[model samples]
Target: MTRNVGGIDRAARIVAGAALILLALTGAIGAWGWIGVLLLATGLLSVCPAYLPFGFSTCKAK
Candidate 1:
């Protein structure tokens, strides 16, 4: 898959994802917080399936 996620977006996703997971683990959030895995995965992969249909992308043209 082509990368649709860019520098800041990727970083935000990773941070948010990690925060959610930590909150879940600490019982500060519901199990649904596990959904953060999706964010983490997308960030790491640099490909966001959600962006496909609308042709959205955060990457700079290269």
Candidate 2:
């Protein structure tokens, strides 16, 4: 898959994902926080399926 996520976006996703997961593990948030896994996965993979529908991409044009 093409990388539609850029550096900043990836970093933000990783941070938010980690925070949500931590909160969920600590029982600070609802189980829904587990959805953070999707963020983490997208960030690491640099591919956002949601962006494809809109033809959006954060990566710099090569």
Candidate 3:
């Protein structure tokens, strides 16, 4: 898939994902927080399926 996630978006995802994961691990947000894995995956892959349906892209034009 194309790299549709831009630098800022990637960074935000990383931060948000990490925080959610940490919260889950600490029992602060319950198991649902583990869903952060999705964010982490999207950030790492530089693609978001949800964004696809809407034709959204955070990446700069190449």
How many steric overlaps are in each model, in order? 0, 0, 0
Candidate closer to the true structure by TM-score (higher is better), 2 or 3: 2
Off by over 4 Å in 3: none
Order of candidate numbers by TM-score, starting with the best = 2, 1, 3
RMSD (CA, angstroms), candidate 2 = 0.6
Model 3 alpha-carbon miss at residue 43, Å: 0.6
The local lDDT score (0 to 100) that residue 5 gets in candidate 2 is 100
Tens-place lDDT digits, model 3, residues 1-62: 87789999998998899899999999998999998999998988899999998889999988
Model 1 misplaced stretches (Cα beyond 4 Å): none
Task: State how far residue 34 of model 3 sits from its true place (Å).
Answer: 0.9
Q: Tens digit of lDDT per residue, candidate 1, span 1-62?
A: 88999999999999999988988898999898898899999989999999999999999999
RMSD, every candidate, angstroms = 0.7, 0.6, 0.8
Q: Please write out the lDDT profile of model 2 over residues 1-62, one tens digit for every residue.
A: 88899999999999999999998999999898999999999999999999999999999999
Shift in Å, residue 60, candidate 3: 0.6
Q: What TM-score number comes out for model 1?
A: 0.95
- Candidates in order, TM-scores: namely 0.95, 0.95, 0.92
lDDT (Cα, 0-100) at 14 in candidate 2: 93
Q: How close to the true structure is residue 40 of candidate 1, measured as C-alpha lDDT?
A: 92
